[model samples]
Target: MLPKEAYDAGHYVGVVAHSTANNGDSADGERNYESTTWQNAFVHFFVDDQKIEQVANTDYICYGAGHTANHLGYVQVELCQTTDAAKFTKAYAMYTWLLAKLLFNRKLSVVDGVTLMSHAQVSAKWKESDHTDPIEYLASHGKTWANLVADVSANYKEMEGTDLKLQTLILYSGDADLQVAADLAQHFCCPIVQVAFATSDLLLSATTKYQVGGASAPAGVTLLSGADRYATMHAVLTLLGK
Candidate 1:
């Protein structure tokens, strides 16, 4: 159902397949993805060693949260399998990356608490059902909520400037988004500074929508906006003159 509409809930939750095959085969996971799609037991994404597939529309809702309201309110993601340590590590990274991507697409910061959630967290608060997920699986690996959120934050920073180089600095008018600064430096192969004021290019949402706080751009830089992260990143590159 979420595939057909928008997720007004503006929240996302994570889950793990309670039962999966011992053989972590891509074909096997693909079959599961297809089955879930047809069975109408849909979730937004499925992550395995083979791929991270989006089965439903994130703008809409999907089931598997174990309750009616949440079933339709949150974007549900299922990690394919992790019966052992090696598999867990890979699946964990993929899950973290996917979560960061989703958060970025939604214009939410990794530090923002409103959108990210655990299935167990939903159950505990809403009494929608009495099941905890991925938690039990994560606990066995010595991972916790703090660890997961940190991973997302880390991944989100990387996304802000993947494959980017380090000549350009970021400028802004209103607030600033510095999460991408370290990443920009990594890609630019050096450090980039934040300055003030630029043009308006990316306005998918509000002009200053994705800007971060506390950090200020230089006193008089152009407040340019990228159409999406790609444009913003390139604009930064162009400004860097790299």
Candidate 2:
């Protein structure tokens, strides 16, 4: 078992993102491995294509980066590695969203290299850990550090004001669907979000939900979907009397 320790800062100052560096691993597999080797190193959460699995409580510190980051009270999360493009896409969505959720939960703004950082940033800044990860792996999937930051910031913005009223929403999965969804959103004055799964954390309460292409909205969301993308767009437009 890992030793129990509180952060030197009392509460977490920010979040650090890491990758398992072991290709083709799932969150469950990573958590299982950490279960044995946690004394060496571990993080709070592991994210893969299917789910975000919590391995340790973020209320306490976990030994992920180096002593500097750990003692500074930075919440660390690991992204499980995968080779398959589709799986990587799915996992990346969840990973970014999870990071944003963590920051939002703490009421922290998404400030790249400060509040939200890649493991590479942590290594470079602290100089205690020689490891730089998730950066190269993300580049393999055609994503840049800027891209991750933008996505996380977007997610953070969407989740910023839960008390605000957003009566309608448009959700899309692919590029084509996004075009249609964008048109509908502009026409109907509804918020639009890209989603990867039926049970996405991005789901917000709305009187009507417009789901396009592959992704499904969460259950009991008053969803409007069709047999196809065009049909779904048509349904949304017609319902709004377009």
Candidate 3:
């Protein structure tokens, strides 16, 4: 389940619902909603034997996707039955409707290349030992995760810039700080600066000198300052590297 804020914040991308038959025997009794007098009886949406049940608001997070709270970002829908042989026509319809609503409400293009990932994509731990869900069932029906990702990526603008770089600065002070700075710098393909200034206040001052590639600080370069001069310098250096 997701809260309205999550969707409004662009924190979540799409929805996913599972068929109950995949969990165990189909004859298992249904969820007893009478036990709890809540506004919604089931998940945000449910794909059952015959139809898609809109039980709750799509904005609320439900009790699915295992233990990871971040998974709450996804709109989770579950089917009443779980079996490999279960027909997914109803599930597909629900998914289509959910996507239509999300795209329309969010002002996103229907062909926008945004991902609709499975729980497995968010956490490998869920499938590391033995557990598997949509992936397994989808595979049986001639679908693949790669295909899904590709489809979303092709239609979503947000998915296009996966390789964009963010510039940062990292400063080093302690013995290990230089190593950390260097490692991060190498990763970001950026410059690393080494500087010495009086007082922690000047450590990060925009006017502080910085060394990069054994070169002195260029003209117009500014420095950062803070209470923990050394740590702050290290952080700046690391960020620069990044």
TM-score of each: 0.56, 0.68, 0.41
Error of 2 at 164 (Å): 3.4
Worst lDDT run of 10 residues, candidate 1, spans 204-213
Candidate 2 error regions (>4 Å): 166-242
By lDDT, highest first, what's the ranking?
A: 2, 1, 3
Which lDDT value does model 1 have at 187? 56
TM-score of 3: 0.41
Model 3: per-residue Cα lDDT at residue 33: 47
The whole-model C-alpha lDDT of candidate 3 against the native structure comes to: 0.46
**Candidate 2 lDDT tens digits, 96-197:** 999999999989899999999888999999898888888999999999999999999999988876545466777777776788778878876988887664
Best by TM-score: 2
The Cα local distance difference test for each model comes to 0.56, 0.84, 0.46
On the 0 to 100 scale, the lDDT of residue 147 in model 3 is 55
Ranking by TM-score: 2, 1, 3
What's the lDDT for residue 150 in model 2?
A: 99
Query: Model 2: how large is the Cα RMSD against the reference?
Result: 13.4
Measured by lDDT, the strongest candidate is: 2
